[model samples]
Target: MAAPALGAQEAAAAAHMLSLPAEAFGNDPNVEMVWAVKAYQHAQVYFNLISSVDPKFLKLTKADDQIYSDFRKRFSDLKIDVLDSEDMKSGPAKEKWRPFCLQFDGVVEDFNYGTLLRLDCSRGYTEENTVFATRIQFFAIEIARNREGYNSVVYDSAKEANLGTEVVSSG
Candidate 1:
């Protein structure tokens, strides 16, 4: 029947769309880390671009304010160091950075939940760091701060390595 044929064709298209790219192998240890770093970098660029227009658009709203509040509460509820919005504000440079942990629980039924991860935001003068959060949470907190004109203090550690590179003098 025509309906059966159409359904079969649709299934094939869906599978193709879900297929992974050619280079996604689980052999290397750094692959996941590299992917995460790239994702975070892209998110920063996108967040800056959008925040430049409507600053307050990402702030906690009545309908969904609890989401952000709940996320932060988890830190305190767990007796971990609680870094509120005030802590997120930029501050004077310091000799060392304080590290904090974030707890995340994804929405999907089969997805991992209750994962705690640590992040050091020493480069960024702000005390709060969302590096361990999901992309949505990262954007939410970062955008809210960006809206308030609190610039991100996160500095790239890679720059320090680059700084150590030496050039040979010509004879």
Candidate 2:
């Protein structure tokens, strides 16, 4: 009975494994690491838009789609704090995000794969500001952040002056 219980516990833990398997990053020579290129391009486009446009006017979803409002309704119960390392890496948060993100698997391109999300919405996608998240996790959090007015700092005059410079200087 104890052996069975331990197996069950392990199975449960495995369900929430958030880290992408190393092999899944593409070991095959023919694949040629397209996922990496796609992820990098995705980050560039995201940062380019945020660095220049006011978040309020930024439209991530189609006009009819309600991803932003839907994220608010579904995850309202979760206490979203500073969106620090814990929210991106902790088991509890990953478990919660997994199902929510998986729901968009067929809808959003590369919904389950790792992508870059900026730690602070106002900042550029620099090594210090970036974090890894599933594509939908990035969308869900950013859509909500943009909608709730938390991302207004991107448009601040001082930041705007440095925005182009930051992206060019960033590695």
Name the best candidate (by lDDT).
Answer: 2
Q: Candidate 1 local accuracy as lDDT?
A: 0.36
RMSD of each: 15.2, 13.0
What are the per-residue Cα lDDT tens digits for candidate 1 across 1-171? 011222566556534533555366545454444444444444445444443444345443332354444544533332122334333333521111122222223432212211112233222222244434434344334433444344332222333333455332321
lDDT by residue for model 2 (7-65), tens: 55544443333244557545654233334445666787776676678877787855214
Runs of candidate 1 exceeding 4 Å displacement: 1-24, 29-41, 59-64, 75-133, 136-140, 143-171
Q: With candidate 2 superimposed using the best TM-score fit, by how many Å does residue 98's alpha carbon deviate from the native?
A: 1.4
| Predictions in order: lDDT | 0.36, 0.66
Q: How does residue 23 of candidate 1 score in lDDT?
A: 67
Task: Give the C-alpha miss distance for residue 80 in model 1, angstroms.
Answer: 14
The residue pairs that clash in candidate 1, if any, are 124-153, 124-154
